[model samples]
Target: MSLDSWAVPSNTGSMELTDTTPVHLIHVDPDVNMARFYGIELQPTLFGEVSVLRTWGRIGTNGQAMMVTYDDEAQAADALHELERQKRRRGYVPAGT
Candidate 1:
């Protein structure tokens, strides 16, 4: 099996996304043996449901993911923000910064 099977499909235009931009975070500390990545994205599916997609695991690998679907975009967006905040508090930083 491949990682794609475990992840949501790429934005192929069939399902609309409120925010196409995903938040990417990373934590790297050689001394602590910590090198991981976490990402959060909000997407709307064709079934009229909003989903918050979260992926986290060691850097340089596909990692793991957990997705939660909500009835409205507001709820999904809120979940995404909350997850980002929690990860940030745990030492995850914006990938480019």
Candidate 2:
């Protein structure tokens, strides 16, 4: 079994990472814009700095990307959790059944 199979694909185009524990991605496209949140580990060459990448753009158009690096995974996860909470409050849901 592969990790991909465990993901829940939301109509919003972001995959919910089920295979990987504590990993999450959320993308929500409201009427006028698109917002995304992601949390992941840093590459070894980067000295294991975790990061949260966020993005916002005009719906159906291009947007900007922002990456915030953390000294450790715990901090990154907290950031991810906070953003996820905000998205959920705004009614973002995982797509697939």
Candidate number of the best TM-score: 1
For model 2, the stretches where C-alpha displacement exceeds 4 angstroms are 1-45, 95-97
List model 1 lDDT by residue over 5-92, tens digit each. 8797665654676666899999999998999999999877778788888899999899999989999887888888888899999999
lDDT, residue 41, model 2: 27
Per-residue CA lDDT of model 2 for 1-97, tens digit only, reads 8988779654641222222344334566667566554433222114545556665544344456667877766676677777767766765554331
**TM-score of each candidate?**
0.79, 0.50
Q: Report lDDT per candidate.
A: 0.87, 0.54
Candidate 2 global CA lDDT score: 0.54
Candidate 1 lowest-lDDT run of ten: 9-18
Cα TM-score of candidate 1: 0.79
Clashes of each: 0, 2
